[model samples]
Target chain A: MFLNLFLLLAAVLCAFQAIRARQMLAAALWLACTSAIVAWLLYALGAQEVAVIELSVGAGLVTILFVFGITIAGEEIQEVGSLVPWAVAGGIALALIGLVAWFVLPAQEASTAVSEPSFSVMVWENRGLDMLVQIGLIFAGVLGILGILAEKETAEEQARASQKTPTSTPPLPQPQVITTDAHQDTPIKEAHA
Target chain B: MSSELTITAVTVLCLLGVALYGLLIVRNLFQVIIALQILVKGALIALVLAGKISGQINLGQSLAVTVIVADTIVAVVGLALAVQVKRYTGSLDVKNLSTLRR
Candidate 1:
């Protein structure tokens, strides 16, 4: 019980740090830590299958994606604005929690002995459609990422082409010839007058 | 009240609250995605907890797995969008995304 409490507290702390970290990379790392802890919490809660998935996808894959985003987007430390928004958001969150508590506490006695089928049977037989849809969603996500990246490459190529184009240069000023003869100078001066 | 359930409930609530607050105030696109992940994690835990309470552990686990898969796709797509937004706007600020409407 104490260990569970410790893990939960650690998860919360990591999550807080992830939100408050000024550096995007640090935030991503903190998020990974939170995910890892959350996976452990899930394991403790008897959701071993979900725990493994969360560990790999949540902590592993998500962190890699975040780092990739940071590399491309270039991390900038965003300044925190006024506390008004934070306060307002906090109030709303508190109200939400209160509402949930009101609804959930009354149903605390609803817990029963778990007697479900094996995890594999549940996922393969019962949730087969969901699994198929998940596969489709992953495929769509991959296609979308490819399209976005391809567009980025095209934009970069266009920018490069524009840079490579030769700019028009202004014609050089004509050289002025000074005649040693006074006769030549007198005619030019007369023409100007 | 079962102490285990109470603890899990409180933890889930705190996670949701923190994520909601971050989502509300964070201006960075990356942070928005991070906040969303946090929110989903809270929900994931809640789902498992519900499953435990209702004595359908397998169903809860299956739903959580589905959520993980979907959340991963969301993270990937969101990051991809963030990259494109950065490419177009030259910054990761959410405020700059407003110019897209124009």
Candidate 2:
């Protein structure tokens, strides 16, 4: 029990750092730490299968994706906006959620049954439709990411082509005239004329 | 409620509050996505905890798995969009996206 509390506290701290960190890479790393802690918490809660999935997808894959995004986007260290209004709003919403959880969650009685089906049976038999939907969602996400990246590549190519155009077509060169004497006013006057 | 359950609930609330506050104040698109991820993580814990309390552990685990898959997709798509936005606008600030209105 004490260990669980410690892990939860650590997770919250990491999540707070992730939100408050100025460097994008640091923030992503902190988020990964939080995800790892959350996975541990899930394991303690008897959701071993979910815990493994969370560890891999949330802590591993998501962090890599965030790092890749940071590298591509580049970090912008803008001044944080005033937080007074946002804080107040968050506090109110949090209070509401707390009230709901307090009142509604404890009302459900825990089950006493000791025997339960295996995780595979639960997922494949009871949640088959959800699995199918998840497959579709994954496919859609891949296509969407591909489309977005492809558009970025095309935009970059167009920009490069536009930049190269001026260099490709050189400007006409002007003729240079050399003077033999500083006192040669006739040539200068003729040129001016 | 059990002490362990109470602690879990408090943790969930803290995560949710922090994520909400971050979402409200963060201007960078990446930070916004991070906040969303935090928010979902809190929901995932709450779902599992609810399952444990109500004696539907398998059901909760199955649902949590589904959520993880979905959340991953969200992160991927969000990151892809952030990259595109940065490429077009030269910055990751969400405010710059307002130019799209024009």
Candidate 3:
């Protein structure tokens, strides 16, 4: 119990930094730390399968992707103080969540000690379909992103090729769009067209 | 010492609230994604905990795996789009982007 509390406290500290950090990279780092802690939390809770997934994808892959995003969308680090209102509000919300969680999660789960099944059984028998879908979804994402990037590359090539001088220096990391999420759920659309 | 389930669930809720707060007020697009990641993690925690509570551990594992997969896909695509936006405007402020069309 003390261990869990420690880990959760560490996560809370990370979350606070994630929200309060001045640099985007710092925030991303804090988030990564939080993800890693959560993975450990899962393992302690006897969900080794989910823990591994969370560790690899959430802590590993997602952090890399976040760094990639931050790098691609480079921005000057601005001073982050004067956001006290945000901090206060976050604190209250966190407290409220703590209370809700205490009430919502049953005490029985603490004592419900079931022996764990083999990992292979879980994967082969019950979750084979989910695994297959996961594989397919990953491939689709790769193909879609490749297509989008290739399209962008060719466009750049044409633009650069048309100009008398090869000046492709305008690819600074300005996050100039609000529609990142809608198409994220459907990278396959790019693959189709 | 609180039960493992209570500690885990409390952590999950803490994460959710922190991420929600970030989503509501933080504007750095990458940070927003981080917030979203936390939210997904919360779902994952709940899945694992629910399974433990009900003795359906495999089912919970399956669902958590699915969520992880979907979350990864979303992260990849989201970053790619963010890259596209960066290439287009040469800025990552999210405030600069207002329209879908050029």
Question: Any runs in candidate 2 off by more than 4 Å, and if so which?
Answer: A82-86, A114-116, A163-170, A173-193
Per-residue error (Å), model 2, residue B37: 0.6
If both were scored by TM-score, which would come out higher, candidate 2 or candidate 3?
2
lDDT of 1: 0.85
lDDT per residue as tens, model 3, A113-137: 5775666787777678877888899
lDDT of 1 by residue, A105-124 (tens): 55554545766789999999
DockQ of 1: 0.62
Error of 3 at A35 (Å): 1.8
lDDT of 2 by residue, B1-102 (tens): 587888888888888888888887788889899999999999999889888887888988989888888999999999988887787778888888986554
Residue pairs in candidate 3 whose N, alpha carbon or C atoms collide under 3 angstroms: A173-B91, A173-B92, A174-B90, A174-B91, A174-B92, A175-B91, A175-B92, A175-B93, A176-B97
**How do the predictions measure up, each by TM-score?**
0.87, 0.86, 0.77
Candidate number with greatest DockQ: 2
lDDT of 1 by residue, B1-102 (tens): 477777887788889888988887788888889999999999999899888778787899999988998999999999999888887778878888887675
i-RMSD per candidate, Å: 1.8, 2.0, 3.3
Score candidate 1 by TM-score against the native.
0.87
Candidate DockQ values, in order, are 0.62, 0.64, 0.43
